[model samples]
Target: MSRRSLLRGFSGLGTAGALAALTGCGVPAAYVEAGDRSAADRSARDKSLVFANWPLYIDTDDKNTSKRPTLDAFSKRSGISVKYTEEINDNDEFFGKISPALMNHQETGRDLIVISDWMAARFVRLGWVQEMDRAKQPNVAKYLDPQLSSPAFDKGRLHSVPWQSGITGIAYNKKRLGREIKHTSELWEPSLKGKVTLLSGLDEAFALLMQGDGVDITRWTADDFHRMCDQVEKYVKNKQIRRFTGNDYIKDLSTGDVLACQAYSGDVIQLQADNPDIEFVVPEEGAELWAESMMIPNLARHKSNAEKLIDYYYEPEVAAELAAWVNYVCPVPAAREVLASSKDKDTAELAEDPLIFPDDAMRKRLAIARDITSGERVEFAKRWNAIVGL
Candidate 1:
């Protein structure tokens, strides 16, 4: 399955009632204290860890699908057997599955898991994950992209490390549109009415729109959010927006039914492979840079082993290998040089793909938006979801 198909929807935490239950006024007990979050060290004896992640998010052997080259190397090098499961289909579903045990101060039967940063904020707020030891992860400290090191929700990345990074930006069929779209505001051009789509998920859609209005997304106010929503509401009423979508926009754009739409950088990479006319732009106004992050959950028995595995992927060579397959933004900037030096022509060319290793100029336009706070999630999700009719 395509990565877009597995990762696009935000329905896992879509409902206001569910948002309330997870993040609203009551339920102080849902917050785990630091003192109670850790379990006794068993890594020295067990030498194994269970890692759960989204489907198609990792690199695999091209010939024998079962062979994961990098993962196998990690196991061989560290002697830490990994039981990796691609079981986290959605953030909310996975949360629901393991939350019962976590809330009750029990093992989640897994050491580490990956989820989007917005959802990672929820886990960080509730302290459902443990702080990683940077001392044990020197490569992570040395090579992690500076842009991803500090997010509002996890300053200095105390509890999480990005597995892969991507941009949420405007994508258009340059040939079909007969013009380039340089700004988010261009999506609203009269000629483009009924031919443009926006992402339906509230979390996925809002920041890019706010950026178009010249809002500084890192510290945007509720007024900024509401004003952006007001504009979208007007566009929706007038039929300017073809529809709010998930990855389905890929099909629409590909078939020429939709000329341009909000798109994920990774999906656009795959699309451009089949149709180079399709182009993803990090708007002049700016775009939201996001990550699917890895976290070691509270009371995980293999915390030490998990830390080593996280650090291992941070090695530039290993990161380059993964980036070559995934085609998402690599969180380790140094990996670009590694790929550029590859003897394989196609692999060497990936080093120049801005979508994967964003140029310095492009980096200036990318910002990690501030996360929605637990207190604000219910109210904001209610308003945004109402606009998208979710």
Candidate 2:
């Protein structure tokens, strides 16, 4: 899954309606007052920024435990002290923690955060995050992938910016299967009965399965969703699927407990290094091209500092360095060239990997799944959880 994190649910209700009345729970109006920060207000803020992100996401050195050179360099050059914290473990958990603060119009104590685009869309819709000033992010304005610029959720480059990207595709043990897997339907093949796994998380699992049925992910319908669920029900009854999982699917595939499973492109990159037999396939049906985006929370104290830090990473050379260690899809197209000129052979070779800089062939097979709307979340989560038995 692209780690597209967001929550959705039914609109007309009693509990939800009461909550809605208290905090205007439905999607908030798009940035009318949200984007009105002046240059003076931005400049008068502190030179420090607080960033909240997921764990095990950035590059770290094995030898020197205290130093994050990239971050350190940014601080040195820009005089911005970045207090980076890996406080996000799960989407729903983090939302529960911060929503109360946002509901009361209080600061969430975070200047910036990196979250899956699906979840980012919720913050964008709820007006919990502020619109970024692209003028301060000159490199970002120039280098952000055109494909990610205007998601259906956020119609412009106004609310969020992609931090890194990945694809939701197939990862299988080539040696165990003795054949390459190329399509989503192949997971249900008779020979592979009880040898496959799907993600249990609704936000992470839904779109790729939908695409298996040849559904257009950009505009998938309820009928499309139901059809996929029906197929899953049949698979469950036939015992063709072992079980659903989160990141544990990686361990299952590695230990040979399962021969095949749905996988994130970024995870496959790391797994392939340790076990060369593990192969990632871009299925013929299509895959979700997703990103964990960066956004500024509303009433943040260091908005300008956060914008500057965002642009620093946008520099192609800087982006390439981070991509080399992280191994996710690089959203900056220009970074490919920067990577190609690397002093290290291993780094330069990353420029040639189709997964990182997807070629025309692979690009044609990727789609950004339409985000599940807030009105659809509750019922959808309920049905999806029941299917996965979560």
Candidate 3:
């Protein structure tokens, strides 16, 4: 059985709607006319495509950081050369860099870009991305995880396909804590009090807390949220929670300052490479699954070629190659078999790691919370930010 998804909430900044909310920049009324969203496909004429993604996000040669093998293979197979750039670091900064052109209904000068699904939500709302031609992407339709499709931001995933996926769960030092944390509520156990930390970001913390409340987070309500806030606030006042945190929770967990904390699955996987005592759990209640996705900006000159590249990566062999390096949840489950059969001991070992390939029991506990709408964002952020003291 498949699992539910978690907050399609924004990653770095608040909802990708901050600018749209503040200035009404990409409000529905401000969006480009639907007819204006497409630029003529120029894949035939250009024969070259540009893709901008986050750093270390794809497979590369160990000795030569400049060389990317999977993209090279695409260039060789499809004869569509790619100019890949890892220029995006933060979602908001990249948004500021390219929003001017997209808002003006001009090409963003690149054919493809990857960003958190929440940020992609803003582009979809603004009519800044083209509806993908599923006909050209057989591999994507066949291999894209069904759970990731039809997010509130892009129903049926017409505008985005996840590049990689990760979970927001709990990580702890089992030896220091002298126990296993089996559920989100366990963070508040008296033994762990003042040694536990929750994520400081509203988007980051809300879904897990809601799950801990026994709410079905797929349809969690505003009341569910405020009630969660009431509990977290109580924890704060009682010092049950040491403090809310960002990725900084990693260091604290590492140093024994924090015995347990809410954490990203990917970060804990890397941390365990150095310190094996650290443990990551998909709580008995549930955890959030998020993705940074790929989309073609509106009016991109190489839409067809871009679509082919997206489909190419979805092929299990290709996804496995990328998954081996990135170590995020493999969106293409078929990739697990490929990795399991690999000759390299390290690569094959990844196939069994539940964080990279969640087992059936864990899958049931993963939930994708609905994203806060632009209106709800203003209201929710005020309440949550105050609690986190942001």
Candidate 4:
């Protein structure tokens, strides 16, 4: 399956049934206390940690697909063997797989895992993950992006660390369109009717559209959400929106079937390499900055080793190397200089790609939207999903 498909599959616990279980009636019994969220540390004796993440998320060796350079470097330097598994294909599915172990106060048999921040919020809320010892993660303290330093769900990042960050922005075929798209309102112009698309997932789609209406996403209200939906519903009925899509938006943009669409920054970078006509724009109004984050699950045996691994990836040099391969916004700002000094021409040019290391002006326009709260999830999702036809 494509990485985008895995990134967004099934809207991960957003269905009505799942929402009911998570926030319906009284507080659920699955909540773990801070005191019970840990197990005895075994890093000194084990010298190993198991990591579970999405497929194709990390940087791999060009010559050997099986080898991950940054991970290998960490293993070589720390002498800590990593048992990495690409076992998390969908958030809700993975949650069902491990929640039993977590809620039961038993070991999950894995030390570290990565999941989107929305789902990470669920883990943090239920106290299913442990906090990192910042004293042991100096590199992360020094190099992590300020914009991602704190989120509403994980204030000051007590329980999670971002793996890679991306932008939910507008992408257009500039050459074919014969003009620039500087604002989100431009999508509604009659010239582009029936030639636009939006993301299908509620969590994936709402923020940017809300931003288009000049709403401050960091603290947007329920009324702002309903207004955005009303506008989309009108467009949908008039055929102004060609369709709602997932990662398949790439094909539509590439073939000129869709002039513009909601797109992810990393995917647009890959598309631009093959077709320079494709241009990604963080609109004048604004855009949503999002991340898939890393967390150490409760009862992990190699907690110390996992903390070391997390810090190692924060080193600018290691971050730059991974940024070159993954093409997402680097969560470590200082890595830009490391990439700028690269001996390889392609590697060096990546330093200036705003998508990878967004410049000052762009930074001002990007905001991490506050996540959909548990109280709001069921009602908001029902209305949003209904319009998207999910």
Highest lDDT among the candidates is held by which one? 1
Ranking by TM-score: 1, 4, 3, 2
Against the hidden reference, what TM-scores do the models get?
0.96, 0.91, 0.92, 0.95
lDDT tens readout by residue for model 4, 152-254: 9999998999999999999999999999999999999999999999988788888999999999999999999999999999999999999998778988999
RMSD of each: 2.0, 4.1, 3.9, 2.1
- lDDT of each residue in 136-191, candidate 3, tens digit only: 99998999887777787888999899999989889999888787889888888898
TM-score quality measure for candidate 3: 0.92
Alpha-carbon runs more than 4 Å astray in model 1: 11-29
Q: Which clashing pairs does model 1 show?
A: none
The residue-level lDDT of candidate 3 at 70 comes to 95
- C-alpha lDDT values of all predictions: 0.90, 0.80, 0.83, 0.89
Tens digits of per-residue lDDT for model 2 on 1-390?
222221122111222334455456654333324544222334344678899988766666779856677788899998888899978766656766677666556778888898778888888777788888888899998999888888888887697888899998889999999998989989999999999988876777888999988999999988888888889988988999998877777889999999999888888887888899999988998988988889888788888888888999999988887888778899998999999998889989999998899998999989999988777876776677777875
Better lDDT candidate (2, 3): 3
How do the residues 287-376 of candidate 1 rate in per-residue lDDT, one tens digit apiece? Answer: 999999999999999999999999999999999999999999999999999999999999999999999999999999999999877667
* Clash pairs for candidate 4: none
Give candidate 3 regions above 4 Å deviation: 1-29
Error of 1 at 234 (Å): 0.4
